[model samples]
Target: MEIDFTNIKVIGFDADDTLWVNETYFREAEEEVGKLLSIYETPNKIDQELFKMEIKNLPTYGYGIKGFVLSMIELAIELSNGSVSNDIISKMLAIGKDMINKPIELLVGVEQVLSTLSKDYKLIVATKGDLLDQERKLENSGLLKYFHHIEVLSEKEEKNYSKLLQHLEIEPSEFLMIGNSLKSDVLPLVNMGSQAIHIPFHTTWQHEEVSHKDGHSSAFKTVKTITDVLNIIY
Candidate 1:
C-alpha cells in the first residue's frame, strides 16, 4: 500500500491500542474483580451481571475508570447482601487509577515512527476514552508534545471524524487516520473518504475490533506492527 505523505497535512491517531497499551490493563482489572465476585456467582453469571451494570451506567458515567468503578460498586452492592463496603471499592479504585498512572510501554517502533512522522505532518490525537485518563496517560508517557491537537471523545463515529476534519479545516482526502481499531479509528475515516492505516495491536477492547471483508480493500490497509506503517506512508 504505497502512500504519499507530502499531501497529507494532518495525521490523526487513536490513543489507546494505537500509541501505547490500554485495553489489556482494563481486562486485567476486570478479571481481578471477577475473581472477587465469583464468591457470590459463577464466572459466566458474573460476566452477565457485570455487563448489565455496564449498559445501565453508560448513560450516566460513560467510559473509563469512573464508570468501571461505578459498575463494580453496583455489582458489589447487588451481590453482597446490600452491604457493599467502601474498603473493597476503594481498593479497586486504587487499582484502576494505577492502571492509568502506571508507565506505558509503547508498542515496538511506536515512538520512532511518530517522531519521524511528526517532523513532516501535522499530528493530532483523535482518541475516545475517559477524558482525564487519556490526558494523564499522554502526559505521563511524555508524548504529549508530538500532537498539536488532543481530542478525547465519548464516541468514535463517522460524525466524530467529520467534526475533526471540519475543525482542522481540511478535506477528508487530505487527512489520514492511523490506529489499531477498525471500528473507531479506521473505518469511520475510510467511510468519510479519508485514508486509513490499520496497525493491528495484540490486545484490543471488545468494541473496537471490526470485521474486514475481502471486497473492501481500497479504503483499509492492515499492518502487523507500527514499523510496517513507515513502508507505506513515509
Candidate 2:
C-alpha cells in the first residue's frame, strides 16, 4: 500500500468526476434540451446537429457549461429558421447556469486520501473545463488547499499535458496524470512517456469517450476508484 511513486515529484489530477460529481447535471440538462429539440427535430438529427455545433465552437470556447449552452442556443435557433424565441434561449441558458452553480460533491473518501497523500507528493490539479466555473467549484469544495498548483486547461490533448510538464520543469517520466477518461487523461500522458492511472467513473459524458487505441496500453493502468490509485501509486 506504500509503494513509492518512482521519479514522480508531482502528481496531476483531473477535477471533474475524479474528485467530484460533475457530469450528472450536464447530462440531465442535455436530456432536457434534447426533449425540447425533439418536438422540432428528430432525436438523432438533433444529436447530430448539436454535435456539429460543439465541434465547431469547442476550439474557440473550450469546455464546460458556457460552450454547451451556446451550442444548444445556436442549434435551436438554426432549427427554428432563426425564429426561436429569446425566451426559450434564456430558459435554456438559465438551466445551464443553474447547473454551473450547483454544489460540488466530492467523491467518498477523496478528502481523506488527498490529505494523506499531500504530505508526500506535490499534488497539482490539472483539470480541463470552463476556467471560472472550475475555479469556483474548487474553491467551494474546500479542497483547493490540498493542491500546490491548479491548471484549468481548454483541452486535454497531449500538447496540454506536455505544456504543463514543461511549466513544472519535470520530464514526463517524473509525473503522473490521474483521471477518469481513458481518452483524455491516460492516452496523452502515456504517449508523452509519463504514467497515467485511470480511475474509471460510473458515467462519462458522450463527448468525453473515445475509442482506445492499442499503442499506449502498456504505459497506462486502471483502477476501480480514485482512492485505489493512492494505494497503488504510493
Candidate 3:
C-alpha cells in the first residue's frame, strides 16, 4: 500500500530497537541469569518464568532495566525457595550494571534517516522506559540534537498517543510514528488517525509481539530498514 505522508508535520520515533540495540542485551542477560540459576531450573524454563515475572511486575515497576533486574532477583529468590545467596544476587546486579553501562550501538542508517527527516519534519522520540536511562542514552547516542521533543512514556497505547498528540498541539492526521514494534509505535498512531512507518528490528521482545487478530489499519507502512523510510516519504 502507498501510504502518503504529505500531511505529516511531526514524526515520533521509538528509541531502543528502533534506532539502537536494546532487546539484544536483555536476551543476553536472560541467558546469563538462566545459567546463574541453572541448578534450580532449565534455561528455557528460567527464560519463560522471567518473562512472566516481568509482565506481572510491569504495572508496579513500569519499564526499564531496574524493573527487569528486580524481576530477575525475585525469580531467583523464588526458584531457590528463599535460599538464593548474596553472591548470586550480586552477580545479577552486575549483569544489570553491565547492560546499563554498555556502549550504545546505533542501527545502520539511523543517523542518515534522522538527519534527513529532521530538516523537513519535526522529529521527537516517543519511547517508553525509565526517564533517566532513556535520557542518558539520548545523551550518549549523540543523536539528541535531532529531536524537537523527547517523551519517555509509561505506556504507548492509543490513549497515550492521543495525549502526546494533544500535547503537541497537532491533530493526529499531522503526526506520524516510526518504530520497531507494531504494537507500540505503529498501531496506536494508526488507530488515532495518524500515519506510521514500521522498521522491524532483528529481534523483538515477546511482550511487543502482536497477532493478526488484533486488526491493524491501512494507515501504516512496514519497511525493511530505517533507510527505506526515505523512499516512502520522498
lDDT of 1 by residue, 80-171 (tens): 88876777778777877777676887877878888998998999999877898888888877888889899998888888788878999999
Cα displacement (Å) at residue 75, model 2: 0.3
lDDT of each: 0.80, 0.84, 0.92
- For residues 179-218, write the lDDT of model 3, one tens digit per residue: 9998898887777788988888888899999997553546
Candidate 3 — worst ten consecutive residues by lDDT sum? Answer: 212-221
Query: Across residues 85-111, which tens digit of lDDT does each residue of candidate 2 receive?
Result: 777888898888899889889998789
Name the lDDT value of residue 219 in candidate 2: 60
lDDT of 3 at 63: 96
Ranking by TM-score: 3, 2, 1
TM-score of each: 0.90, 0.92, 0.97
- Model 3: runs farther than 4 Å from truth? 213-217
Lowest-sum lDDT 10-residue window in model 1: 207-216
Task: Per model, state how many residue pairs clash.
Answer: 0, 1, 0
Tell me how far the alpha carbon of residue 61 in candidate 1 is from the true structure, in angstroms, after superposition. Answer: 1.3
